[model samples]
Target: MLQRASNANQYFTHWVTAAPESRELLALCLRKLRGLNKVRIIDASFVWTEPHSKRIKVRVTVQQEAFEGAIIQQSFEVEYVVASQQCPDCAKSYTANVWRASVQVRQKVPHKRTFLYLEQLMLKHSAHKETINIKEVKDGLDFFFAQRNHAEKFVDFLSSVTPVRVKKSQALISMDIHTSTKSYKFTYSCELVPICKDDLVCLPIKLAKQIGSIFPLALCHRIGTSINLLDPNTLQTADLPSNTYWRAPFASLANATELVEFVVLDIEPLGEQSGRFFLAEATVARASDMGVNDNTYFCRTHLGAVLHPGDSVMGYHLTGTNFNDPQFQELENSSTYSSRIPDVLLVKKFYARKKKPKRNWRLKRMAKDEGELLPKKADQDRMDADYEMFLRDVEEDVEMRNTLALYKAENKKEADAMSMTETDLDDDDEVPKISMDELLEDFEDLQVGE
Candidate 1:
């Protein structure tokens, strides 16, 4: 209890630790002095120096009418002690490799082009933001998350954009006997379809019949949520959905690595046209066999609109070539599909280039953590080749370039100022380049030093 001063009426002061506000402090004082007689709190006000100040002054007014029907007032002050603390869940985030769930994405193919494309898609959609860490493995990438739901969300994103089959499993991490609580670490093993764009996939007989009766030897022209295939002989196109692909999956017989160059001897376009593809018959001879032999191959191609008589083209030579795939062997043995198979399936027309053209624009790459184990010399070379192929595809395919962010190269002015020889000028004219309008200025480099 507090009483009036002997010399004069004085205001009383009190200190409180971590008291919230004036109203709460007044309530606390009222509760403490509830047992006292004829004492009532009228109002209270608080003033703080800063928004998050640790100390505050609270003025609380009290009224006492016990002395000869006269009223007396008093004030009080409180100081709060602020401290920081972390909960168990938040503390786990600061620790290394403390993920509760992980998604291991894998592809059985021998190249990394598909993974590079998937990385761009994930970055464009901002799907990788939820992941705690992304580590690159030999075949694919592994995404880690602090929660199972985050991993599931990432898996859903992968399934939506690409053809992948997911196998989920959970491991027991910890258990509490008193609370009957169990902690689990979940793992999602996701395997992407081995097929990629521009690859020659030998579809299963039954699967081919189901997808619009297209040819078994079809070229994967485009791959999105579904695999888009084109039959060069008939110019017929079909789509193989992700679900259908996983149920009866088949591998690609030949990819860009197996492409054999051929010079177009003659080309005549037919009246039939499907979008950008024009049906035409072409007489092509192997580039290696041009001067040695007069042998030439007569085949149907869909690139008639773009190909010229003297142009070089890349295609897969099927005649006299033996493949170990069961699907290809079955097609070869079957009387129904054996005769319909073409000797050559032209993939893309090639442009003459003595050297790589100087580009004024560049693409941004995702910062991914490749594992600590250094790759072997052969594996490293293969990876480099695959990345170069991906870069070329990005440059040639306008649709692909649209999905990625292109920035103006920092050395664009220097590249533009450099003089090119006659040969370099000719190469620059032949090679595809991105326009300046399509590239965005990168302002991240504009930050001035503090």
Candidate 2:
């Protein structure tokens, strides 16, 4: 429904097709009323069609009573069509159309003078007969009247009308600005470790292969136990711990000593089968010997290690010992390592897949075994039983439905004659009619060239 204001206190209503409980229509009405700051609602009502119509009609009327004793009245009528389908067995139909109607009145008024009057009322209503200071009273009067355009006259009148008391105290006036563009910022961080043979960290070959499969972007850097002795002055390099051991076949690159920490840059999701993963940047920060026993070794902790400025490593890596048991088995098997590797690089990938879709195989097999199951007269019997129950429930009361139907039939007959007479009267007046095509042409001509 649409409406246009013809004057300050009048409007022309244009009825359009709409749902009774449409949020869009409600929002439009609210926006119109909000824009008219001085308008005060007096009363409102809605009219709606009952069930069983191709289209339900909604009518609403609202009156604004605050415009210089003027009334701004508006009416809207809208139609909505319902969709329905019939049941195959009983031939009974059900509709999906539903609507609700509600009307409310709202008013807006200026409250500056009312607030001042309320303050005065509070002072007058006080039970204690405390003496009010003349200077304080004068200050109060001045402050109250200073808000109005006729400040001098208002202040004089206030002073003559009442006495008041005032007290001085520091009061902070604060204002906060909330903007739509304000947003939240998030921080992300990650750590990277460069591979070293002396680190006493012998990851399972299967684990290495799984890591490679999952994080193809990761580059493994192999270093031997001899690399720790490169600086002979540091005797701390060769002292192996009692419980850890270093593995063999390490790389000879000294440049490997410089890279250490890795950081995550971004993450992206692959398809449902591949899963989501992260891309990261990493660089070496510190080189140190890990303590080793006879067969096992542990990498030493490097303090204050920092990745080089801009080298980004992309791959997934595991941190902390929390692999699932079955996953642990996968890590142990060399064949599995050759097949699919888990990523243990700084860049990580997490895969997600759709669950298996439900299949109606059981139902299909049952149907095939049973052949066709046709609806019997049992449905009619059930309907008869339902009708009997409905009658039993209403047998003792007056038939309101029947009474309404009779009344509507009589009223409809009268309405038909009245409508015919109204049509005759309209025919006598001979209103000028424009063809729809002509109206469309006129509307098109009115459009500005663009």
Which clashing pairs does model 1 show? none
For candidate 2, lDDT tens digit of each residue in 359-380? Answer: 1110000001112333258843
Clashes of each: 0, 31
> Candidate 2 vs. truth: CA RMSD?
39.8
Residue 117's lDDT in candidate 1: 85
Q: Relative to the true structure, how large is the alpha-carbon lDDT of every model?
A: 0.76, 0.26
